[model samples]
Target: MIIQPKQRNIAYRCPECASSIFGIVGKFALSADMLRLKCSCDKGSALDINKTNDGKIRLSVPCLFCKQNHSYVVSESVFFDRDKFLLNCPYTGMDIAFIGDEQTVNSELARTEEEIRRLMAGFEAEDISELQPEDMNEDEILPDPAVYDTLRFLVKDLEAEGKLECLCNEGSYELRFCDGGVQVYCERCGATYTFGATTPALAEEYLNIDYLKLK
Candidate 1:
């Protein structure tokens, strides 16, 4: 006997670019069916349709890397037949992250959101005046404006204290950006220091250090 599969409409949004893609998918095609959905912006996601142990349909989606929040949408049979579908960042060709099941995914998402809220509360309690710029001085060369400004100010502060000098104390240094990070090297003593913002979140933490004591 041959049984015809069911069809449903599923929509996806990129996590990074927030671009949307929609398509009609089969409900009972196979246990592990993957449909590649690419947004017009070039980023995409592979929607995997699988059957749970309890004979339920499952959809696995990849999330974005840059964004802090994970997004999802739920539709009755037309979209996913379930409560929700995993979302991915649209800037990249593929989703940057994937979790096992929906239950675990929701739990993880709640934890992540709560952590972000707590961190924001902590940041709000701190004196952020020093971190804020009074004037507009933007450097297009640096990937992160905050890091560039902070390092520039740190150098000026160290120079005023005569501590920006290399180990020889008479050597001069040069700062440059490379491989998405900043590097400082001395011409006379060959002393070098590098600050990298490998991820967006780590950029500020890297710039918040005392660079004068790198002897």
Candidate 2:
């Protein structure tokens, strides 16, 4: 199924111009660019990411309430690190996802400008009905806003500092990550902590929040 833009829904309709607001994200081949989010009204914006992250892929489109656009840099971990990670992209049925980046996104827009211009020209001349489709059934299930905001800040920082470290407590421990689920165990302490779980307590260890919530 095609990924539908979130804005066309009745709920996100604008009170001012009644224009739809949407946030789209995708990457181009071999480039780190966040595709420009274009509105039917000709409003376009770009975002930039610092390359130090060198992560896989990430995108943060603005909310319906606010039109400011933002982009993120993430690595394969976003998809591969999930608890029940799907091996493929549902929209394209592809093994790899078109990860979003600002630079890559701009290239796509430039390449497609002619097609887009044709569409826009038709739109300007005709009094066309709003071809708003239904909202997508499978929205990107991001973390709850309160929680997601913190992860955006912490995950990269911890990963960058090489501080996402795991130390063995009194008990023997094991660490395993496959298909997005991880297992951190202390065989000596006979303890285990799943991501974001605080259960299976360990005697002595430094743990990240994702690992602590598994309880």
Candidate 3:
């Protein structure tokens, strides 16, 4: 008879691009000095797992909400024995990383995404009249906040599904908002995709985009 090694699913939202990253960690891997899980954005956003000499586990997590990296340490048993474990950002109380069975990790990620959408919608409901004249920069024309947020959400969703790409295969993409539209550009190779985001109709049209290639 053979005993299978214990394994756990891990997931985190990238601080740089807000894309969900998923991976699996095996019990044997914990025996090593360190393990790193990186996001596809290739922007230095990653989760690090380190094994201490005292037989404990150390986790370095990147938080999408706080835009920060947080560190925590726990016993080996707590790290590997739990059916579900979540690490959250202290500032926002937002879950930064998830470790557990595949189903639970995926469910938590979906819930988090839905919660963020609702929060953004709530912000959009605020009165536009509340903005003071001092808040406007005469020389800077900003894009519609709601439209920009929608574009950002769509871009991250595409990124998570591996549907966003760049002409230069090695380059990773990032999103930028302009006066009337949004841009998806590769940081390394300068490949770009620009499209209008001045209206909800334009943003909704992108929902049908199954793949995007920056050139």
Candidate 4:
């Protein structure tokens, strides 16, 4: 018997900006191991889907949801059994993206458009301050509280002492928190430093080093 090729479709969105990145559909053989795509944002962030050795699909991608990159693994059946797989931000429980077959994605997009229209039909301005990410509880919104707090304090301290200023005389640095850690970046110079925690107390140790040592 001849086996039919599997077709896949993926829809991406940056939860932080509530923006739709893109929708792509393609066909692959049963032996295909991985698929990769990029976000629509100017950042051109990456997203990857890999077929693991254990016959599961693993999604390793940058999340616009919590401003971090992380990985997620799902059973192989997820592709064939469901019309869509909605991936959520593990930290904030916000919908980050969806993947499935082409037909399902098109249908889902139509439904979403209709709902958007219905809501906008009677839309009105309201105070949206409560919706801001900063207003969210750090412990609840961060995937790893210990790492978040440790890095948050360290970066804030560095910034306060002017240790985070770019040598190119550009500007100060800022932190973007994600699943397991944070990204330190300079806006004008585009420099970045990343820290993560794979074991207990790793982030804490990294935060305790002297400023000179950090440089």
Candidate 5:
């Protein structure tokens, strides 16, 4: 007889790139203080797992629907004993992460993607340009909430590290939200760095940037 280690597959969508992230978690993996599951996108987004002194598992999950990180604590049985478990965004009620048997998780993900495609098809038929009033300026349009929030968080982190600067040698900067992206500009020199955030791929790419140079 052979003994198999207790393990379960985990899956989630990259909050920055909207790409599916998959991994496996073993019962022994939690022996450490922390376990991190990072996306292959290399966008700095990851799922952190911590075991509490009380034998509870704490999960820090990143959400694309609400542009926020959510934390949940569960018993060890709930984490490893379930055949399938799903974590959803509280605000949108959309599944943000999955943990269970590999086949179940993969099937659910495919169904979710199909639903999204159907919704997008309907959205494409509408004339979005006509919905906006002709008198409305481009600046009046609100940026995508997920993209805007991600950029804002990145900017704050960069500023804290003293990596955000302008050619004029000024560290003070401001953000301007436009239709498809946001602009970081120097308050004193007016130098600017414009980045696209219209798509998840673009946003994920920007997340890799460590320093911002306004020119």
Candidate 6:
């Protein structure tokens, strides 16, 4: 009996020279919906396959020559050949090639931060005049309430209290800190992974541990 490794279904083409290149597919993270491929030309390209179907997938990297980001697409084929992934930059005609996979930790972390920011923004734009404090017909003074300030203070307080936590973009197990370990778990998924200890001394040792927003 013989054992065989799984084969790839990669394909790419160059933008400038229209050259074809082969790639080695590696790192398939189903949890993160990610796939990584290394191009033969020595340039590495990382993509989010989950985003491809919706036309949201783009080269994980910004355009090297143009520095332009949008308007790029990263699609896959059931019968794709690695040769299709190779291409020259249409704008610069440079040898545009790539190899390698996206680090799920980094990409997912950045994506979570982005979601947090967007949520903060939406919370900011909300009209809270009705929820504001103002003077009444009487001569009584009032406090501003300061919901945002309070929230910020709570965030800091939680960190100091060793309860700082956050959630990743996946909307699953939250990034919670306890016993000096960052855990990813949800009652539903039951997925939990300890990241690091609760102290700074061990922070470096378990630097790669994933964290979640404190609830």
Better of 1 and 3 by TM-score: 3
Q: What is the lDDT of residue 152 in candidate 1?
A: 38
For candidate 4, the per-residue lDDT at 172 reads 48
Task: Point out where model 3 deviates above 4 Å.
Answer: 1-5, 125-215
Q: Over 4 Å off in model 2, which ranges?
A: 1-32, 45-53, 70-73, 79-150, 153-210
Q: What's model 3's overall lDDT?
A: 0.69
How well does candidate 6 match the true structure in TM-score terms?
Answer: 0.24
Supply candidate 4's per-residue lDDT for 185: 60
lDDT digits (tens) for residues 1-215 of candidate 1: 74432554455445535444455565555445544555556444444555546454445553433332222222223233323333333222123332323454445456554644465466673322322234423233225534443443355445445666577767644454556566655657878677665444565575455546434
Q: What is the C-alpha RMSD of each candidate to the true structure, in Å?
A: 19.4, 16.1, 17.2, 17.0, 16.7, 19.5
lDDT of 5 by residue, 35-140 (tens): 8888777576788888888787777887754445666655666678766666655334456788888998899789777755665566673332322234523234
Q: How would you encode candidate 4's per-residue C-alpha lDDT over 1-215 as one tens digit per residue?
A: 85543566776655344455554533344347467677666666667777778775667556543455556655555554555665545454443566777776667666664654454454541322223344445345345644544564566556555566554545545455554566666656767677776333887877675462122
**10 residues in a row with least lDDT, candidate 3:** 125-134
Model 4 clash pairs are none
The lDDT of model 6 is: 0.34
Q: Which candidate wins on TM-score? A: 3
lDDT of each: 0.45, 0.33, 0.69, 0.55, 0.67, 0.34
Task: Estimate, for each residue in 1-215, the C-alpha lDDT of model 2 and write its tens digit.
Answer: 75532211011122223343333333232146544433454343332222235555444433222222233344444432322211111121111112223343344334434543454476673311222223433224321232222333344444444444434433322343322333444435445454452222321123344323222
What TM-score fits each model?
A: 0.29, 0.28, 0.54, 0.46, 0.53, 0.24
In model 2, what is the error at residue 78, expressed in angstroms?
2.2
Cα-based lDDT at residue 203, candidate 3: 81
| Least well predicted 10-residue stretch by lDDT in candidate 5 | 125-134
